[model samples]
Target: MVERRPAGLRHSIKKQMAAVFSLLMMGTILLCWFINNFFLGEYYISKKQNAMFATYQILNMAATNGTLSTDSFDIEFQKNCGKYNINYILLDAESKTLKTSTPDYSTYSQRLLNNLFGENAEHQKLLETGEKYEIQIAEDDRTATEFLEMWGVLDNGNLFLFRSPLESIRESVKLANRFLGEVGIASAIISAVIVYLISRQITKPIEELTGISERMIHLDFDAKYTGKSRTEIAQLGQNINELSYTLEQTISELKSANNELQRDIERKNKIDEMRKEFLANVSHELKTPIALIQGYAEGLKEGISDDEESRNFYCEVIMDEAAKMNNMVKKLMTLNELEFGNEKVEMERFDIVALIRNYLQASELLCRQKEIEVIMEAKKPVYVWADEFMIEEVFGNYFSNALNHIAGKRVIDVKLNRHDNLVRVSVFNTGEQIPEDSLPHIWDKFYKVDKARTRAYGGSGVGLSIVKAVMEALNQKYGAVNYDNGVEFWFELESAGEKVDDEKGMETEESQNG
Candidate 1:
């Protein structure tokens, strides 16, 4: 039974975005409200101070010009005081008003001049100390009025006194509260809309990447990021796309390896069975030779054949069997070397035609003895890449096999045909074709169509196996073809060196016939 995996925690980018943007917007709104509530009172007081300062600056400027008692000074004084909404009094050193902006301060039941600087102990300090300036906020509980008092001594020994009411401030703050409520509502709505749009814009890629991730989790690799922006999110999207490709490739390889692993398991089981059968075949093959050599040796030792000729014949039989065993062992070792890559194939370009011609010349004696007819055709300077010694062995094996198996017309045809980038070298003998069923398996070790005939030739049945292994090690192709009334065993080698041109090939044809 397949076990179920637990689902993991999922984070929603959309909800997180909404929450973050909302909190940010709310935080800004709250900070603005808190500041207005805390500092509005101080802000109003600072404005009154600035107005009073302007009035004082006008008087100081007139005195610096030595024009304090002039009509121009009074004009400048009235203009500055009115502009800053301050009521001013110009007082002489005796503390009596020489000029005043308002003459109706008696309505408050106090002589304004004395009440500001003379009556109040704190206010008296500005009059006594030379160059001393002071500011005071006085609240009138009866009329619910707030006023700022500023007094300073002029450089000309004249006293400058000023007052600015803050009556409008309380009313302005009330109006501000009402206005802020309405504005905040409108701003919140606008901000919410803007924030929502912004959050969507930000989280869109995140959501898409999440979707891609979800699909990737299910092994769907087709979806891809299409964003063209150069943001970090865009880069992340590209990385996710790359991750998808990598995961797809890795999974495919793993699945392929898993299938191969299963096949290897099956093949291992079959190999064990084949090993048992192989041992039986080896035992069978060695048994006959051992029995013959042992019987012949015992016969010689026991004087079963008393004559010298018989003794010599027994020795010959024993030696022949021993020699066959030795040859078989050597062939087995060569095949092992080829199969296991122990045989080093030193590749070199050589004239293949010359190699074949030399091989035929060496076998001339065998051809003559067998009364075999020979046909040879090739192109001159036909170069090929191969291990020369190994190729020579291949040629020898085919030629010897043909010689041993020749029948009927007794003709052996050796031909070299160039096919594209390769040269097919084939040896053909006029004899019975191999059975169709045994064609593919002919290259397997110890496979023979005619067992009796093979035994007669002392064939270990590993020659074609060696041919297959050698060709495979060289990464070349080799096979056999059944022709009419004969069989052809062939192998190919890579064509090397400069190719003979068409014009040169035609001219060399006559010289190539051998």
Candidate 2:
């Protein structure tokens, strides 16, 4: 059963990063709001007080320079007074107004005169006092409005009063804080969304790395991190890719080693079994010849045969058995060399048709004795790539086996056919068909279809096995096919084409004959 992970924002790094960033932004906005609420009002009030002192200085300078009533001074002074929303009255020593910024000059003049005379002193609260001026928070009895007021004596003894409305400054500070709160909330929300999207982009590579790790757990190394980022995450992904490649190569080599180990063990066991079977077959085959030779020798020793011909007969029997044993031993050695890869196969281009004809010519007398008709279907030279000696041995085995088995029509058929780049040579003799069940095992060492018939023909049951080994060494194909009246043994070799010079062909044939 496969396990599944629960899906939720709680387990997501993207969500966590978004939440943390949004919280920081919100915290910053709230900090700004709190600072504005607590300090913005006092800051505005301090700025207004500074503006009033600046007005006082400029008016006192103009009065001393005798330019207090000039149109230039009046224009500059009025501009400053309007910018700060200040109401002012300027009076000479005669208590006559020199310049007044308010439409109702009488009201501001009376206020300034009352301040100098200390009549309205109870209606004021002094904030800062100087040698020539006093700054205060005062209220107007007529309009019930509060002001930051400066009342003082200027140079040349001109009396001046500078006051700005405090209500407007307090209202502006409140409006600014309200505006900041609203904008801060909106900005924090927008900033949070943007940070969340950016965090997701940042985490995309991390997610890819996570998937790669999960696949690695299952030993799949095909998934790779392909991100082109130069961040630490990209470096980590590159490291993981390297680790995955290393592990894949190491594990592949281990698996190959393991498979090779298994094959070695199996081959060793097979070789041991073949050794045991070989010994048993060798012993079995040698038992009869040894028994026959022993019996004939003992008879001759006991003088059982009085006539010289009888003694010669006994000796002949013994010699024949001994010769059979020698032949069997030679075949066994040949089969052993082929099976153990000790036989070196020297490959060369050879005229196979000429070799076949030469072998048939040599065996013509034997064919006549057996009264078997030999038919050759190829007169033209068929050149093929093979070990000439090995191919000759293979052909000899098939011809001998066919000769021994020939019956019915008593005919031997040899053919050479070319297909693509390969030349197939087939030898067919008119005889009993090989049993279907025995066909597959005929190439096995010591396997005979008819044991008695094979024994009569001095067969060691190793000829076809040698054929199998040689064909396998050449990395070619060889097989036997059963027909209705006969079996055909066939083998194929790589073709070397038929376009050789006549002189070269003759030389090759002469070499085989030699």
Question: Candidate 2 overall Cα lDDT vs. reference?
Answer: 0.87
Pairs with backbone N, CA or C atoms under 3 Å apart (clashes), candidate 2:
none
Task: Estimate the TM-score for candidate 1.
Answer: 0.50
Q: Encode model 2's per-residue lDDT on 1-514: one tens digit a residue.
A: 7785543334678878778888888898889878888888778878888988998889888888989879998899889999989999888888899888787988888888888888877778999999999999998998988889999899799888888888898889888889988988898788888888998898899889988988887899999999898899999999999999999999999999999999999889878987998899999999988999999999999999899999999999899898989988988888888877889989999889989999999999999998999988567677899999999999999999999899999989887665567777888898899988999999998899999999887888989988999999999999988888788898989989774334222222112100
lDDT of 1 by residue, 227-284 (tens): 9999999999999999999999999999899999999997788668656755776777
TM-scores vs. true structure, each candidate:
0.50, 0.54
Q: Looking at candidate 2, what is the lDDT of residue 378? A: 65
Off by over 4 Å in 1: 1-223, 228-281, 498-514
Q: For candidate 1, what's the RMSD?
A: 18.3
